[model samples]
Target: MQSTATSIKAYLEEIPEERKIAFTKLRETILENIPKGFVEQMSYGMIGYVVPHSIYPDGYHCEPKLPLPFMGIASQKNFIALYHMGIYANPELLNWFVTEYPKHSTQKLDMGKSCIRFKKMNQIPFELIAALVQKMSVQEWIICYESAFKK
Candidate 1:
C-alpha cells in the first residue's frame, strides 16, 4: 500500500510499530551504502533514494519535476518491498544479484523485475542489497538508464 505520508518522518510514523524496526534498519543500510550524489526523501509513498535535479538536470522521464528514482523501500499489504532501478535496467546487475544472493542468503528470493519482496525482516539480504546499491554512482546510473532506452 502506498503511503500518504509527506515526509520520511511521517512515513515512518505511519508504518506499523512492529514493522518500524525492520524498515528503519533497511533505511539505515541504504543510507550508509548508497553512493554519493543520491538524496533520500519521501517519493512514491516510500523512502526513496534519488538522483537530484542538480545531478541529473532532466529529472525523471515520467515526472520531470521529480528527481530520478534509484531505489525505494515501501510497506505493502503483506510484505516490505525494495525497488532497485539499476537491477531492472541492467541485465548484468540482475544476474549478479540472482547469483550472489544465494551465497549471502538462504532465504527464498521473491522478486519481480525491480522489486524484491520480503515477508519477514530476516529474509532480506542486507549485505547483498548494500553491494547492489553501492555498485553504481549517479553518473553511471544515468548512463545505464539512458542506454536502456536506446536499445
Candidate 2:
C-alpha cells in the first residue's frame, strides 16, 4: 500500500473530499508565508517543506543522511500539525510561544523538539509561525533536527 504520497502537491490533492478545503487552505498559507529557500515535499504521509541538506553541508556531524533542514508538517488521525523545528529548537522561541498563546492548551507544543499540533487550521498562528520559520538559519535548524534524533 502507498504509505505517503511522493510530493506535497499530490498529498494535498489526496486529502479526503470532506477535508480538502481545510487542508488546501492550510497548505496555501504555509506555501505563501515560509521563507524563499524552503521547498515543499510529501514526507511521512503529509506535506513537509525543508531546506534540504544541500544548503547546509556542514550541519550535523552525525546522521548525515537526514536533511539539515528545520521544519515539517504531517496529517495525523485527528489534526494536521505544522511542525516548526525553529520554535522547539530554541529555548527563547519556545518560551515566547507558550506565553503568547495560552489558549493552545489541548494542542502540544514542545520546544525541546519543536512541533505544533493543531486539530484544525484555525488553531495555528500563521504569521507568527511563518516568522519563526523565517528566522531559522539552515545550520541552526540542522542542529535542532540532530538534537531530536540523537540518543
Highest lDDT among the candidates is held by which one? 1
Q: Write the per-residue lDDT of candidate 2 for residues 1-151, one digit (tens) a residue.
A: 2336777666667666656665666667777777666667654455667666668555334555644445676666666666676676577877777776655444455333555666655556655665555666555565665676544
Backbone steric clashes in candidate 2, count: 1
Q: Summarize candidate 1's per-residue lDDT along 26-86 as a digit string, tens digits.
A: 8889999998999999999899999999888888888889999989999888888999999
Give the Å error, residue 84, model 2.
1.7
Cα error, residue 106 of model 2, in Å, equals 11
Q: How far is 49's C-alpha from truth in model 1 (Å)?
A: 0.6
In Å, residue 147's CA in model 1 sits off its true spot by: 1.0
lDDT of each: 0.89, 0.61
Judge candidate 2 at residue 27 and give its lDDT: 69
